[model samples]
Target: MSGDVTLLLQAWRSGDAGARDRLAALVLPELRLLAGRQFRGERAGHTLQPTALVNEAWLRLSGLERIDWQDRAHFVHVAARLMRGILVDHARRRDAAKRDGGQRITLTGLDVPAPEDGLDVMALDAALARLEQLDPDKARVVELRYFGGLGIDETAEALGCSPATVKRHWQAARAWLYDALSPG
Candidate 1:
C-alpha cells in the first residue's frame, strides 16, 4: 500500500493529474486522522474542525506547483506541516480579532505537559521557528512527533533516520520547548 502511495506521489510530482487524485483518495483518511489529533488540542470554542483543517491543508497542498515527494512518509510530513500552518494562521487571525483575549491551544498528549490553561499557538509557533533556525532537524522532530502526532518510528521513517536518533531529538526538542515556553 505504501509503495503504491509512493508511486502515486511520484507520478503526481511528475504532473500526472490522475495520480494526484488517486494519491489524495489514498491518503485522505490518514490525513484526517492526523488533523483530528491536532484539533483535539485546540480550545473548546475553536472554530475550525478537523475536517475543515484537512480541507484547508488539501487546498493549500493542491496549489503547490512542484514538490519532490520522496515517499508516503514525506507526503504525510508535508501534510502535517501544512495543517500546522493552517492552524497557526487561524490562531493568529483569532488573536488579532481579540487582542485582549487571545485564543489558546493546549499542547497535550505529546509527552509534554501544558499549563493548566493552555499555550498561545502563535508563541509556540514563534518558538518553533526559532528552534528551526537553531536546529532544523530537532525542530522537525518536534513537528512530526508533537504537531503531526507521529510516533517515534513513524517520525524516524519520515526523517530518514534511526529511531534512536528520533528519540534523542524528541527528548532534546521537548526540553528546549518546555524551557522556551516557561514563564519567568
Candidate 2:
C-alpha cells in the first residue's frame, strides 16, 4: 500500500491527473484521521470539521504546481502542515472577531502535561515559528509528531532519521514549546 501511494504520488508529480485523484482517494481517510486529531480539543461549535479540513487541504494540494513529493509520508507531512495553517488562520479570524476569545486546543501525546485551560492555536503557531528559527530539525519533529500526528517511526521515515533521533528531537522540542507557551 505504501508503495502504491508512493507510485501514485510520483505519477501525480509527473502530471497524471488520474493518479492525483486516486492518491486523494487512498489518502483521504488518513488525512481525516489526522485532521480529526487536530480538532479534538477545539470548541464544540467549531466551523471546520475533519472532512472540511481534508477537503481544504486537498484543494490546496491540487493547486500546487511543482512539489517534489517523496512518498506517502512526505505527502502527509505537507498536508498536515497545510491543515495547521488553515487552523491557525481560522483561529486568527475568530480571535479578530471575538477579541481574543478564539478556539483553544489541548496539547496531548507530547509525553508532557498540557495546560489546564488548553493553549491558543495562534500562540502555538508563534512558538513553533520561533522554534523553527532556533532549531529547525526539532521544529520539524514537533510538526511531524504534533501537527502531523505521526508516530516516532513514521516521523523518522519522513525525516530520514533514526527513531532514537526522532525521540530526542521530540523530547527537546516538546520541552522547548512547553516553556515557550507557559505563562511567565
Candidate 3:
C-alpha cells in the first residue's frame, strides 16, 4: 500500500466521512475506465452503454462507506464487488421487464465464449454461485479479471500470484463457468 492509501485508510477507520468521499473521488475515474474496458469488445448493437454502466456502478459504489480500504488490492476487490452488484441489478431489472410481458432483455452480446451461444444473466449468476462454492479464490479472480476488466498482470498483483498462475486460473474458471452456465 502507498502512503496516500495508508493515510486514507486511517482516516476512514477514524470515521472521517469526508475521507471516504475523497477515496471515491480518487478511485472513480479508474472505475469508470475499467467499466469501459469491460464493454469494449461488445457487439455494437447492444443496448447498454458503457457510460451508463459505469455511472450505475459509481452510484452503487458510493454507498459503500464501511469498507476497510486496506490497499490497492483491496480497492480492486471491492471495485469488482461493486461491478458485480451493478450487473446483477441490471439483470434483475431485465427479469422484471420480461415478467411484465415486454421485449426479451438480452445480454447475449457479452460474448462469453462458452460452448453455448449466449448467456442470460440468471444463468451467469447461478454459475458464479457454483463457482463460489467450488473455489472462492478462483471465483474472485474471475470477477476481478473479467468483470472488473483487469489484465492478467493486474490480477496477479491483486491476488498475490504470478501472471502465469492468473492466466491458468482465468482459463479454467471461464471454462467451468461456461459449462455451468451453458443452456441444456
Candidate 4:
C-alpha cells in the first residue's frame, strides 16, 4: 500500500492528472487521521474541522511543484508540516483578534505531558523555529514524529537515518521542547 501511494505520488509529480486524483483518494483518510489527532484536545466550537484541515492541506500540497516526492512517508511529512503552518497561522490570526487568546493544542502524543491548559500553537511554532536554528536535524525529528504522526522506523525512513538516531533525536528534541515550552 505504501509502495502504491509512493508510485501515485511520483506519477502525480510527473504530470499525470489521474495520478493526482488517485493519490488524493489514497491518502485522504490518513491525512484526516493526522489532522484529527491535532484537534483531539481543542476546545469546543473550534473553527476548523479535521476534514477541513485535510482539505486545506491538500490544496496547499497541490500547489507545490518542486518537491521530489520521495515516498509515502516523505509526502505525508511535508503535508504534516504544511498543516502545522496552517494551524499556526490560524492561531496567529485569532490571537491578533484576541479571540480566546489564541488556539491551544496538546502535545499529548509527543511523549511529553502536555499542560492542563494545552500549549498555544503560536508559542509552539516559535519554540520550534528556535529549535530549528539550534539543530535542524533534531527539529526535523520532532516535526516528523509529533506533527507528522510518524513512528520511529517511518521517521528514520523519511529522514534517511537510522532508527536509533531517530530515537536519539526524538528524546533530545522532546527534552528541549519541554524546557522551551515550560513556564518559568
User: What is the Cα-based lDDT of residue 2 in candidate 1?
Assistant: 82
**RMSD, candidate 2, Å:** 1.6
Ranking 3 against 4 by TM-score, winner? 4
**How does each model score on lDDT?**
0.82, 0.84, 0.68, 0.86
Instruction: Please give, for residues 85-144, the per-residue lDDT of candidate 3 as tens digits.
Output: 666677677668767321122333233554322345556666788899999878888888
Estimate the TM-score of every prediction. Answer: 0.92, 0.93, 0.78, 0.93
Candidate 2 TM-score versus the reference = 0.93
How far residue 36's Cα lies from its native spot in candidate 2, in Å, is: 1.5
Q: Which candidate is the best by lDDT?
A: 4
Q: CA RMSD for every model?
A: 1.6, 1.6, 3.8, 1.6
By lDDT: ranked, best first = 4, 2, 1, 3
TM-score, predicted candidate 1 vs. hidden true structure: 0.92
Scanning candidate 3 in windows of ten residues, the lowest lDDT window is 101-110
lDDT (10s digit) by residue, model 4, range 72-170: 988978987998999898888888888766877888655555666678888889999999999999999889887887889999999999999999998
Candidate 3, pairs of clashing residues: none
True lDDT of residue 133, candidate 1: 100
